[model samples]
Target: MTEQNVRRRGGGKRKRQRGRGEQAMVPDAEFTSYYGRPVVKASPWQADIPAYLFLGGLAGGSSLLAAGADLAGLPRQRRSARLVASGAIAGSLFALIHDLGRPARFHHMLRVAKVTSPMSVGTWILSAYGPFNALATGGELLGLMPDPVRRSRPGRMLGVAGRPGGIVAALIAPAVASYTAVLLTDTATPSWHAAKRELPFVFVGSAAAASGGMGLVAGPLDESGPARNMAVGGAVLELGASRIMQHSMGIAAEPLRQGTAGTLHTAATALTATGALGAVAVRRSRIASALSGLALTAGSACTRFAMFHAGQASAHDPRYTVVPQRERRDRESSPT
Candidate 1:
């Protein structure tokens, strides 16, 4: 009787253990932040920062074009490009200062040189580029003025310094155009950090497109060939890099394809494509060239704003930060 009871009890205990194991299945935990707060804070940057990004790229590209036009002996195009560069740089500085809330903040940024800090590098780049751009523009303006003013000592000095200044600025133009991409990617924002490899190409291409558009709008039709080429090449680079980045970024790319960012990016892609085509297809028509330039300019601006908003969106959403990290960990842990 005792042996039978002991066997029955053992079988019942084993059955209960199996049942408990089957019923204990837990649902996967949804990715959620502590107290429903965002895992990462969205950057405090305002619209001014995006404006600065666009204007900075525009200025950098224009400086490069101006240097090229100078060497090509296209005086009209050079003049127009220098003017655009100067104006764009000034606007960029204003936007940056405005966002910083004080001119002193910008001055403070210049107090140190840190290779590891994108912002520091960018500030120095701007400093080096700005004076040269100003000198070039001053010379261009002096040339446009009356002979009396152009012959003055100060005017002559600026005019003499202009070409060399433009060449120097051109050397630094690539950094100016692309450093913002590095700055954004260095941040903890999921989308920006994820697309680090492609974002710089996108920024550089956008800069070129914007500069080419300016050339088309303001330069003589006879001298617009270089501008047309830049517009086309830039359009290709921006569109291609953007597509690759979004495709490779996994969940981080969702912000780029949805909501306000998506809408802006769509408009940017369409406008850039249309403008590039127009720059080539209607190269002989002044009216068409101007229209194409306008489209490219608008498109470049949209791209910057799109990226900024996309980063903010990704930072605000917990999943964009958490899921990619978990996936990466799982991949690293998995057997080869």
Candidate 2:
């Protein structure tokens, strides 16, 4: 029977309306199933993953900055960088472990590494990076001990022992900062997977902003010129990348503007902008530096959350998946 006739003749249930034919296919509208059931499984990630992303970026960038500071003979900045790197990694590890639900099982994550697995590779990176950051921070901490204690043999040894580890970590830090985008892109979520090309840039910028902000607060204001510059540059870069992603995604970007994801995105943008402005406008004021640094740190965290939540929202919306695939298939099968 014709769809119209079926609709007019009888209802499927005693009291409910009968189903109707789908709307005509059009450039502006796409069809979805009842209740808009998700087209793919939701990500297994939780709060931990977003937190991990933020902390990892901060740690990675700080490690690089620390290495640079070491070479430049900026002892104070170097020490602060190492401490920030160590603390961020420690928090990242905790969040990761929390996400896993079973801390012991984390060992299995690195049983063997494969090129196909980003998580496994990341596990190895963390395993190597963690020790370096810890040792470097430990060395710095040892130097902070009282004069008598610092002169002790153990203290003297501790002060120099982490230099090599610090160097190695710096070399690996960029990958640690940027690989997170790859991990997100490798997933099936339409929003994240589709924006793979730009996500890495966005993440790298965020890392620089976060790490730079830390440097601003952790070290003397007089020596924070580099930190200020990095913060402003990174924030602008991230903001641009984020806008590019939104435009490139077309209709799929809806999730980024809806519900919880929308709130996070708005917050990230505002904080990043204000923080960046403050960093530049009040360069010599320690109070302004501290506030700007805090703002950027918060903004960086929000960036992770917004992206993750948007990915989930996109996955949860069947139209995002179905429409994009349909368009791709139609284009591929069309006559040349």
Candidate 3:
């Protein structure tokens, strides 16, 4: 055939193939790991960890309130706060040791102080804070004894020392309330790590809510001013921080919005809001104060549990791991 005739023949063959719908096969890809396995292992943690977190925060925040009440000369409120601080710290220590499977494991952690390690620093914080809180509470209890015992030289010395001890504990309280957030965010878990910037705020705010709630429950209306203020401020901070974290985390926050985690978070928000409103609206009613305090404390517990479960959910799901990394890479490669 001639050259032009041959070219026409090739074009006709291509047209025929196109008409037959021949095309490349591009199988749709899914966000998954090899063999559909999880991208990361779920932490070997239980509900005890969340309990420990909540108790530790409660202890820390209560220590701060106790110091403030002492300085303000609100003896009744100071006593209540100191008692709560000591009890919560004890419970926190117990929960942590239970999670570690042995008491010795917790003590072993204090052998060395590592600046880069959140767990190590948290252990030291607890060690220092716990004793001071206990001493302060002891002094408060001593003062409650009959006049004869309270007037004893040893009792007077202890009471004198407790103010300084509690002041030292208050100094370390912020770290106690926030270090758990640092520890969680430092992990490879997608939801927890993505919330690095706001988690500490959420935690500290929850701590304040818990302690303030306790104060409202135990303190009289005349001395509940600080507690009311703390509860309201803490409620605002916790709710705002949670919203910011969810908005900023993108896909990583999905775990927090779905399943059991979502339900808990919703409950926490409602309870905290209601408690804050009740605190402001019914300051004269002891019944209202007790109810509000209970709500706030419950809300704080729910928040901790929600965060714990969300981190586990994100770690178990490959999509939460893969999608964010891919998006990050795309953003890096895109033109500015």
Candidate 4:
């Protein structure tokens, strides 16, 4: 055979070479095995997963904000932060339970602690955080747990135990916001895997901003100064991160710009921007605070749906998988 024929046959002369012969004989359609069984089924993850993720982040962020306010000598801010934090935590737990295919089986997740598994770590974090958050709120509600109890041996023990847990929750708050991104990244989902880095940052920022918005709405204006600042900062970060995500993802980011995902993303962006700006103007006004809070909550919810739909969109398109893999292989084979 001529040299041209050999090169056309994937640069091989052997007639019985399975690798080269397979590529040569099979059409692109046949080579792809697109007609075979699908690589992934529809995600078993329910809507509650997104809801719980958002709420858990809000709780954690609010707790941190409250702690900061308490340190700053803002009594009303501390109270509002504690109250909202507790509510968010409770709502998160409820959503988590509701999402489980077998709600009773959730205990199995805590049967063994595995650091390598995000789910396992998350379960432990929740287990440790839930009660402490509840107690903190309880203490605030019961008028600071009484001077005697605050200083007693049992009180000290409770304080010791609760303090560490609170700190852990605060530290984990950002992770809680971002880990859902990791979950989506590890999957076969196209949009998620493609924009892995940006997704996490966007979620984290949104959570923090949402939490700040809640604090602003619930607390007195003078006490809510920090929350307003935090909300503004978070909104700026989220907007920048999302823009980077869209630009970096190329065609895979199409879902984020179109269809249901597109609509939600646009709404989220608008609400987040509006609320952040409102925070500055309403730092002292209850009415402004209320509107900002509403916007932030709506924005956070829209973000979650946009993310979920983006993943679904990515998974539905075969080109997302095929084109990237082919390009990678081609690049690897080319000489420097």
lDDT of each: 0.91, 0.86, 0.89, 0.76
Model 2 lowest lDDT segment of ten: 8-17
Q: Can you write out model 4's per-residue Cα lDDT over 1-336, one digit (the tens) per residue?
A: 665776555444334565655334333442233365444454777788778878877887788887777678887887788788888888888888888767676788889998877777778787877776766675565556788877888677665555454555566556656676677776777787888878888887888788888887788876777888778887888889989989988778888878998999999999999998898775667888878977886788788888888778767666666666777799999998
Q: After superposing candidate 2 on the true structure, give the runs of residues whose Cα lies further than 4 Å from its correct spot.
A: 1-36, 147-149
Across 88-166, the per-residue lDDT of candidate 1 in tens digits comes to 9899999999999999999999999999999999999999989888888888888879998989888889889988999
TM-score of 4: 0.82
Reference-based lDDT, residue 176, model 2: 89
Candidate 2 residue-wise lDDT, 216-321, digit = tens? 8897787787778778899999999989988988787889898999999999999999999999999878989989988998899999999999999888778888
Candidate 4 Cα misplacement greater than 4 A, ranges: 1-39, 144-168
lDDT by residue for model 3 over 58-132, one digit each (tens)? 988888998989899898998899888888988988989989998899989988999899999999988888888
The lDDT leader among the candidates is: 1
TM-score of 3: 0.92
Candidate 4 has an lDDT of: 0.76
How many pairs collide in each candidate, listed in order? 0, 0, 0, 0
Clashing pairs in 4: none
Full candidate order by lDDT, most accurate first:
1, 3, 2, 4
TM-score of each: 0.93, 0.88, 0.92, 0.82
- Enumerate residue pairs that collide in model 1: none
* Top TM-score prediction, candidate number: 1
